[model samples]
Target: MPAGKSQYRKGEYPTFEDYSIYAQRVVLNGEFVQHSHDFDEIVLILSGTGEHLVGQRVYSLKRGDVFVIKGETRHGFRGAENLELVNVMYDPRILLSGEGDLRAVAGFAYLFLVQPAIAQQEEYPYAVFLDEDATETASTLCGFLIRQLEDCAGQYQVAVQYGFKTLAAYLANHYRTREDLSEKLGIFTRAVQYLQYNAARPIKLQEVAEAAAVSQRHLERVFFEVCGLSPMAYLLELRLRHASLLLRGTSKTVAEIAGECGFEDPSYFARVFKRKYGAPPNQCRNAKAL
Candidate 1:
């Protein structure tokens, strides 16, 4: 590993060689500019609600939500009033290729080495969500690591190694991959992910179908079966949701917010926003002000 600075400075400066494990407890009353990191990150939400823009998908965050952010992916956090969380950053090599007894295990090799390699090779910024119990266990281990790093206690490095491995193993057990999914299901899943990642763009059915390696008609069938919404319908829902968040979080005018969220027509955006939230966009902004 080498000491290198990522262009990202919204959080702490991330350097892989300085520490294999970097943990931070962050509180954001505002927003984090869209940025990317040079290393993988695990985020455990401790409190508050917010929206996480990872790639093109916007995930609504709440307590007990856990997310894995692969390296070099663009992400942002916004509209959180009292957002707090523990973010753990580590070099993938620490667990993937690092010399360790865990490497000998078949499951470990499959989860850490083989699966991640495939994901990287395929260029998918996939994320994993932990269950409630797993999230609690992860949070506890992450807390210990954060405290030890801050305290500089004796033998903290040993603790870091132990805790990091334990957390990795825990996640490996609960982790699910899309690699084993059925073709139709896999295509549908990717289509959903595509919408999440590109909902704010001028997307079309043909593009999404191509991304899934399927025809538009076939994709529509699977999407309706799995998500009960057409791709365009889902994209509209995502755009409207983003518009609502902007209305509450920033003072941007309705037109500006609409454009930013991918709605070309301000009047159409207003109509949809009003229908979804039961209030007009300007009224929503005003209500938030009070």
Candidate 2:
């Protein structure tokens, strides 16, 4: 993001600590000039279709798809239609802040983008599939930002912060472990599906363990290691997350959704939900009405 060359209408954002997020609508109807970014970026294709040429490689992109641009990896785009792109440029130091300050992401300097087929555990620079969680957040943030950009409201800055928060929440939760392949690769879809589908059911470690065909102890180890959560804790999160969705999206009563999503007591559900989401179910639901 440099100063005042918005003919790309592509301008740098200000005051973003770790990274900057930008929305570009490409309508040039042809190829773009070759350029590169010094920082790491994860770009989402919000609408339209195009091909990204990085060095000698040509990658096709479509709606609901995303790609990662490694630092200093030469790349450019060619859009045949109205292409909506969301670019998240990050400071590698922030990502390496918690882990050792080694340049692990520097690996991407040669690879360019992480294509979807290999987007599993090997899915370095991961992208999302059309599953419930991925699709919901992808469309929501894209739509929200597009609206803010269109309206140019005085509260646009607040909306922009919120937009980044939603993207952060989505990526922090789903980025590393995304894949659907069962054999040959331990894709995350199976584990997430197991947690969501059986959240309300009698979830014993052995059940998911056997379902995944791995031993109970091994499954427990990976659940925490890979997902950053224990089996039971993840189950609680799934139930609560779904219950929150129901509260916001429907007129359903809290008691009804609590039971539907697996809580036996409405009062206890309210207490736990409040603790997790920072508000009681009724308040969260009513906040929607506001």
Q: Per-prediction TM-score, please?
A: 0.50, 0.44
For every model shown, the clashing-pair count is 4, 1
Residue 185, candidate 1: how far off, in angstroms? 7.5
lDDT of 2: 0.55
Weakest ten-residue segment in model 2 by summed lDDT: 1-10
In candidate 2, how many clashes are counted? Answer: 1
Name the lDDT value of residue 218 in candidate 2. 72
Model 2 regions more than 4 Å off = 1-188, 287-290
Per-residue lDDT of model 2, residues 12-127, tens digit only: 54423222345434343456655665445667666667776555556566665555555446567765466666665553323322323222232221122223223323323333
- Alpha-carbon deviation at 200 in model 2, angstroms: 3.1
**Model 1 score (lDDT):** 0.66
RMSD of 2: 14.6
